[model samples]
Target: MVGRGGVLRRTGGAVVLGTSLLGRLRRRDPGDAILRRAARLTLVASVVFFGCRYGAGSSTLATYGLFGTIAAGSFAQLPGPARRRARILVQSLPVVWALIAVGSLLAWSTWAAAGGMLVVGFVVAFAGVGNPRLVGLASAFQLFYILASFPPYQPGTLPERLGGVTLAVALLAAAEVFLWPDPVPVSYRQRLAEAADGIAAFLDATAGRLTDPHAAAVDRDTRRERAHDAVTAIELNRSPPASAPTAAGAQDRALRICAAALREVLAEADRLAADAPAEPIPDLAAARLLSSCADTTRAAGRSLSPGAPAVAAADLDGAVGRAEAAYPVGAGNARDAPDVPRLCRDATALALADQVRVFAVGCRVATGARLVGDDASSGLFEYARHSPWTLYWWQFRSHLAPRSAHLHSSLRLAVALAIARVAAGVLQLTHGFWVLLATLTVLRTSAADTRTALRPAVLGTIVGAVVSGGVMLLVDELIVYAIVLPVTMLLAFGVGRLLGPVWQQALFTVLLTVVFAQLGPEGWRLAEARLVDVLLGTVIGVLAGVAMWPRGAGHDLRYNAARYLAANADAVDQTVQAVLGAVPPPEGALDRVRRRMVLIDSSYCQYHSERHDPHRQQLNWDAVLSAGHHVLPGAESLLRRNPPGCLAGWPEAAALLRDSAGRLRSAYDTLAEEATHGGTAARPPVSTRCVDQLDRIRPLLGEADLESVRHLVEVDRWLAGLADSLTRISPPAADELVGHRRKP
Candidate 1:
């Protein structure tokens, strides 16, 4: 199989699996900046650590300096230009000092330390909601706090500790900027713009094929895969540590929604390509509409970046107006003959246009367009338009509830650390921090994730401990130990998480062993203590993960996802009723969808990150989640395309939509109900009812205006999309899954 780096790959599965870590390392690509960054980190560590121990003549300073350096360097997965990373580290000086000081004071007794961990852990983890950069810095802050908290109540030595950390932060910050500086990172906005360009190109190509007789066919699957890749790139890079909040946070946040909107456009375009009618679209106006959509996206792509030309909101509106006018009068053509395939083509084309409209609105909002009259006037930023801190504060405040996965994770970490601290203190473990360290590192958002990571980590730690112990016995010279320390730091910090957590944990254990040994006279018992404390931490972490999810997390995520599904179904009913002139479309539909999307994104992140058990019954979560994402967008698109009183003349067509929506909504309701009550959902019955509704619409299309026809098609397609997705979920899948037993 082809492997990473495209080096040392083997043909057979067995041979490839049999390859060693050494072999893998040999084939590994040590990127230009990473190794230099690691080397720079090593140099800083050596200076701070040895300079403190030998020159200053205090082991406390040495200990804090060494760990502080490590924490500053390795704790966070902060991505960006090196200068940006450096800026974040420099800005962290106050936080680092505060944590260290508080932790030292808390070390007065076991009771204090454990209690402090509860408050400190939650606060640290919870801070991530405001700014994602804090998420990475969280472990570092906690590590520093834990480093200070677990001790012989050495509050007097707090200055030495704080001084060491300050020195380390300064050195690391300098190293990040001046030494081995990282190349400027491509902005996620640029990536989103690029994705927009690709999707737009696909739309253009598809439209040409639809309108022109000689145009070549394009493959839908290839376009879908392309769009999928684009989405992955955007999603992965979008939240990379943001710089100091100016309007930057607000601007960046707007881009994020824009990215989401573009993602929908890609998804819709993919479906449009696949569902294109065999016969060329009879109405060239529909083809022209699709072409206009492509133009809209291209304009969006050009204008998304900060320096790009400012695009007026009216430009987009005018494009839509022109496309609307292009539609031929439906009088003579629709009077005699009913064209079902042609109507379906028109619907598919309109679906693309609807998604494009959403993207257009999103783009305008992102570009700071504040003049669309009503919905687009205040835009997505709304009240927080000028104030980024307000936005950050609100984001933080929103997740305070128990229902939020962010809160759950914060609580989970806090509780786990508190328990671990108490256990370490009561047991009188020599290296008490090791117990907390193990728990902090091993525990994840859920128990299942912890379980997945625990086995390999435990194995790797045991092996590393044995090797470390042997080194301690064999190497008596302090000179040798000092020399090896920087080398180990280089390998551990410089190299990426080598071959998952196994090598990572093992190498880290070894690296720490070297650092600790250099600081003191230790024997094999230190290694033995390390192993014991680590084992204790892992058990507590697993318990904590499970506790938070079902009180462990698996159950909570499913229920959360199910609630979104059920809500989307309700939204479907609302939009359909609104279309039928029964009532205005429900307000806050977008807000509800946005909240659900956020919850699912956070809750299932851990689940999606791990490899699933292929043999077991698992829900088609991707399908369910996609259906959830589409619901609000579909609602908005339907309502936007159909104005008030438009459906008054087409009562039969409106009824057709309402009836079909009832069946579609019922399927989702069943799935959601089953998902909430238990893990299993019975297979939703396939219905001919949608086809019957289409039959009802066929006669109406003959006499309806192009506007009416397009709206009718959009309504049908929206429900049809939901039905197709929901029907794919069955009892055979996710039957043994957990549902939230403790309802929030």
Candidate 2:
């Protein structure tokens, strides 16, 4: 009876697992599932059909088609159909031709080929710096050298090879256009709604944090980051393809306006949260009102989707009115306010009411309600028009400098390839191309990344050899090989996609083994040789990474952080100048600054993922980044509230703000120089002139103008904090201050 129970339990477990797998497959969107399946099936069918038609002599042509299809698939993963088609057609052609030209030259003479390949590797690697498309092209070029090395070198077959690759690219492009194309309008709407929801959630959290001072800082940062990402995504989707109608443009514009307004509201909430009282506020009425506003904003977000009911303007107005009534402006008449706890409560209530008002107005704008007063302009969406050739030339020129990552990578690649070629030739390895392939696949921008890949590459190669040998021993008929080929391709592709670098390498090795097996009878022998070559290549790649350049993502982090600080300083300077009427704001200058922040955030994520740490360096960098994030939104708020004409009456305040901007800019320059050159400069003193001017001007201004001055004070405080943080991280030498102007 016990034995019977164990058998039943095992059967039940197997059934449950199988059902779960099937459920997951069925849960995928039908259109997406069908599209992916069809693409893979089409790739497999084309390869098989061509191989059969051309016979063994033209197997290289079939291999070319397989490679072209894979490359096109990588490009097709871009967001929209039109973009996918353009990238595949234009960006891919030159790369394909360049690969073919280089591979063909190798057939002429060994010495000439070695020299030419070294130069080509260096140039391609350098071109890839800072440009994702160029990096993909570089990989393709290396892949061609690896795969097409042993094919027949007859000049007569060149045209046929080119034609085969071209056909594959065309087929994949067509599939991308017709197969369940990603609908831009729907995606744009969903992304906008998600941004709105993030803003609402942030507001709710701010309110909660006000009531309790022990709220988690990490959670707050994560929410803010997500909100920023959502806004960026909306910006990217703003310009649809020309085929989209005028109405699409209008819809995109409306969404952008909504996102901008929500961003402003979030900035206000962040300020309020930061200034929360030490003692918990017991204002239940104000708390309830804030919660109501959050609920209404969430409903507005939902209404952004098609077929949902729009949020009513009246509902938003009612929430604002209740909040105002609960915490009336200037309600308390106590002169000097002796009770500190009571004053803190009153201050918290006032800030909450102000946030609710701002949020309600933003919600109304998002839902398309007619404004009762002047319509706030979110600025026009400006798109740059540059020809493809011009853009390519600019990329080339920008990365030509010595400090550029592209230049270093290119030089490193050239040296590595030359060494690998020389070593392989001296050893007289029959399959020397495998060494080149391994080196190309393993080496990356960072030593850490290259080292991380080594173990996986070696293990995957061994596993692939064993698997291929076993399969060959089990099956001997051509018909059997044909039947198993598609299944193997599907499994390998699926596993590679689902796993990390380790699994991806293993699957790729497996596919290569299967491909070579079809070429001849000595399949197991070739697999063993391939494994040995891979081991050698990985060692060389790791050594190159360690010995050359050696600086990885951590170095990139410092460079990018310095760039971000410099951009922020410039932004603050420009905003102050515009407000004082010193100079008109450069078109899209603020937007450009915000975009640079996004880029820095991306670089930080990449740096954080690396597996090295200098404890003090990481902590210092984190502090600088945190201070920068706080300064950015505050500066934007000050600009929005204090426009040119509004600040005309406060000349002294304007001058103080200008001086603060200049000091901050100077400090940033010193910081950037220190970060880049590893040489410290004297830190500028923290200025109090802005604070003093704000205090003097506050009593003379009206309620609206007073609010604007308060924002400027907040920005000034943040700048001081930033300067102090930088000083703590890297203090200057006394001798370096000889000619520098000291702050009085």
Candidate 3:
């Protein structure tokens, strides 16, 4: 035996190594370090405790059931208040112990235990079920997981085995709460902040191009969308339990106040854009000011907390102040200089008064000092009465499309899992069943890539199997149990960080398999079989994902671009209308304009990402998008200054404005035709068209509209100039079209 000094040295060295490793993890991300340490500690303690009671091979069936129950619960819940309730239930229930106790008393068969599990699984899946559209889908998946566990090998008493499943859930529930809990509940304030920031960034980037009429219209549409999203977030947060204390409770109250202020601001901006006469406007100081206010509002969003309501309040105050400071008045005069300033001053005061009124109302409700009228709060009724079911199934609605994609994929995945399990049983690979599950879980990308995702799945499984195999060698039961827990925790954390879904799942599966590896040689033999099952499942899942009603990244790229451009067109009209009508734009119009630009930015970023993507299975819309980039910014800049319909009467401004609009429309048509026919030859003559439009508007340079339309004209001029840069291809070579150069 080694000397005591030698043992001490080895123990000291191990401590140093552990400390160094933990320090490294901490440096990577403090949050992750905390999570890993907590997870590891819990796993170690639980494994040791459970091992002492149940021994090496007893709880395999229980563990499996537990995993499935947790999966069903996680997948079924709607990730809000319900998720919290589910967590509490899972933690408090001692479900595994109860199931096993009942099973022992009843002496149920393996299949009977499995049948009972199916019922329990369904109940968990359907618990607190709201949103009917999602219910069927959740139930279907629950069935699949239940069936996947079937036909493997019946545990001694089904009830006893099922009890272990409950135990597994209890462990997970405890992990969730005592481990790093999610800090903030989803709240209106958070949503408002995110939406506001996105719009503000979009506006700043594309502000220079705001003068172009179509671009202005697009900006307006995008802004409206942001407003909608912000409103929705607020509404969701305020639903029932509105006064309950949570992380963002104060922030939610502040967001409600800010949302009202934002709405008023949006209307004002619109009026300004709508009322300006048809002149060649140059500066966009007013629009920029409003955008700055939005930026301030977004900044307030970052500091959301009940204790610091001042951050959000200050933002709302700033937005009101900026709006007051920015609104126009007559030029200063000896007799009336200060009076004109009073007009804006009064407007600012009015906005502040409204904000205070709403705040007091919400405060009364929050503090239980008094109740506020129903009308005092915004977006309350809008969210409560809205049918999410109708919303989910409404295929005609563009906003709802993302949900459909999610639903379709979920169902197909369920079907694939069910089929894979059945195949696994036939192949005699029980562990392979989990390997297949791991593979399915790990595969990423919009479309399933068998080749790319397959490697990780196979590698993870083989590695996990090998690891489990080695751990079995150190079979002094307590030592085996003790070492496995910490190692599994370490492996899980490391793999989760280092790998994508497949590798992560593989790691998780491997850890789980280690826990189950103590089962008789039959279970060990089933490990190889599991690989075959996984391979088969992966094949089925990928095929299902691709076979029917499939969507790829390419189609979305074009749709997003088109939709964004369409919104831009609307924003341009709003701004132009403001200019030509010789009226002050409505409050909040600029906010709407800025929101539209954000959507275009999102589309552009998406397009850029997809263009160079290694997954080249989809159509590349990058070329058209690139051409589009050359045009939109310049257009948006012009619209910002000119405010489409409200421009001052400069010489050729209107004609120039009209001409640019035509060119954009033509370009859009050309792109549509090219996309349809698979060629660019059908595109219109953008250069000649742009040049002609500019020349027509050039004559108005001497007029006041010329000065008013400056921003818009400059943008139009830039677009025309860029269109000239692109080589234009005439379809049928003109001569060929005339049947003179060549015979058809």
Candidate 4:
């Protein structure tokens, strides 16, 4: 009924809107990585599905083939270069085959299927603790098992189903290598190298500043920010793939600790550089120390690459010794008094020497001893060594604790999948896998988090249901459904994440509707069944969430944080004693602290994912984690840096250092106690006390080798960071702990 001009105007507007959308997509997905992936997946899926459905003339083959591509391509989230990803997929085939085989054997009854789901779901979810690649593939593995577990129990079709899956994976893996492959992401070692470079520059710049005190090209605060920024990049970018049970493992923990040590060095440098005179420097000892640290840190960084000249921890040790003999100790007020600017500079320089030595150990562990062989695979990487099963067993054993969110989440997943399987079986739904699919995708760590996402998901499902039902009612051409399926897939899978969870669910529903419509005879009733099954699954997911660990990691954040601090405090105590006796610190000290750190990271990750009540008090968890981060390295620095054991001639300094360690240990214990008992008291001096104590120790240094003061100053720097982090805890009130869960 419209005029030609009117129609032209409307069509022009549609074209403009589409163009705008395309522009936005380009901006959001920069290199079009999402589009590239969507296109690659679409081509592979279309070819596999069509060949099985029309060429092979087996509905089972077609169904498995299509879902196989979805599971592997969309769900697995394989990372790395295309060749590596393909290799990892090839290696995962045995596990996939076992899952399908077990799934077929268990689909005969509700009880068997539900029990299988419970056990299989737990194993797969819990396996993520082993490595990053395993975590990436977990959902795909779960999806495949769920697919074979629901309805039409036919062991006879296992061959076709398995063949179809193999075909899809084989083609997809080949396509991943040959097709438009993803650009290689920045490697973890590369990031570590970059961080080392940043630290080196900062230290070198600080040395220049120390040489010319009054005038500087760069500000101290600015240099510190740049160094910290690099550390942040390493934290965010590095995710080392444990490539083999023994062949894999990146020593990420070591890399992080090393990075932490470097960060500490920069901070200590800046603090000591504060408010000093601009005239010709009274002492070049501090300047030489900075230069040595810069050179040693740079060498360590270079060795992170595949083929760099090897550098040892001994190089750093030698550098410190040279610097110690580089300048004679002052004979005046500056000799023993830290309040004097000259002594303060010297003290700060010693602290840095301690941190750079820790940096050497970090480099050795991360580079697989290719660079520095002194401390490789000892403290952190010792347990995570060369056997895959050994690595897996250790990871598994470590995360088995009751407070681990990984354990709780695994349990929650098992329960939800089991309940969904039971519900689908009892209700006798024709396409029951949809029910399990809903439950698998929708359930969250806590009841509250699951409930938060429920409304949008349910609404999206209803909208999807209506649209799919309308498509079925209004259209009847068989060829039309087939023709549009791949197109729908491209848009759905590619752009879904760009939208929120609502659009993702809605598009997935539309995608499934088109898929099922082609596989068998169906009416609008298929759409009706999907809506009902999703609602049923949603209800089960929420119920299971409530029944299991209803509270997520935030509930245990304080407890775990406190526990972490206690372990770190103990590590410090043990290291100080070992240094005093000049022996290796107890081996168990590193192990306990490493284990606690892993637990805290897990808890912190889950805490962010969970839904918190708006009224609850916000905790400064970053500060707490940062504070805890300083503990082990600080202790290690103390143990490794001092040569003469400071216990001989420097009796007063040795006693003071020993006393300070006890005080820090007590302070950490008190902070842990407060964190445990509602965090009501202000944790004063956890942050600033060590810097203040550094002043007290400076005046008492009575005529000794300047290097003898290194161990105590390093310990103070560590304690200062630890105390600062502990004091930042703003814990929730007593009632807010579980208040969000008690909905009226």
Candidate that scores best on lDDT: 4
Worst 10 residues of 1 by lDDT: 735-744
* TM-score, predicted candidate 2 vs. hidden true structure: 0.59
Report residue 577 deviation for candidate 2 (angstroms): 11
TM-scores for every predicted model = 0.82, 0.59, 0.52, 0.85
Question: What C-alpha lDDT, on a 0 to 100 scale, does residue 151 get in candidate 2?
Answer: 31
* lDDT by residue for model 1 (1-744), tens: 356535444345446665664566545634555567678888999999999988998899899998898888877656668887889999988998999999999898999999999999999988877676676688898999999998778778989999999999999899888877877767766777788877877777777666554456545346556766776566521233332111223454556556556665665565555545455645565667777787888787778777777555465456556655543344225455534445555555555565565566666666666534543432343533445587677667666766777788788899999999999999999899998888887787655567777886688789789988898888778888788887888877655354556767777888888888767776667788889999999888888877765333345557787878877877788777777788776666656766665555455543433334445445655455556545665666557667655676787787788888888877877777766665554564443232444565677765676557656766777777667657656543243233311100
Worst 10 residues of 4 by lDDT: 239-248
lDDT of 2 by residue, 449-522 (tens): 67766777888788877777677777676666656666556655553434445655666677666666665666
Each candidate structure's count of clashing pairs: 11, 0, 120, 14
lDDT (10s digit) by residue, model 3, range 206-245: 3323334345657666765675455434322133222212
How good is model 1 by TM-score? Answer: 0.82
Give the lDDT of residue 325 in candidate 2.
51
Pitting candidate 3 against candidate 4, the one with the higher TM-score is 4
| lDDT, candidate 4, at 423 | 81
When 2 and 4 are scored with lDDT, the better candidate is 4
Error of 2 at 242 (Å): 23
- Candidate 4's TM-score: 0.85
Q: After superposition, how far is residue 220 of candidate 4 from its true place, in Å?
A: 5.8
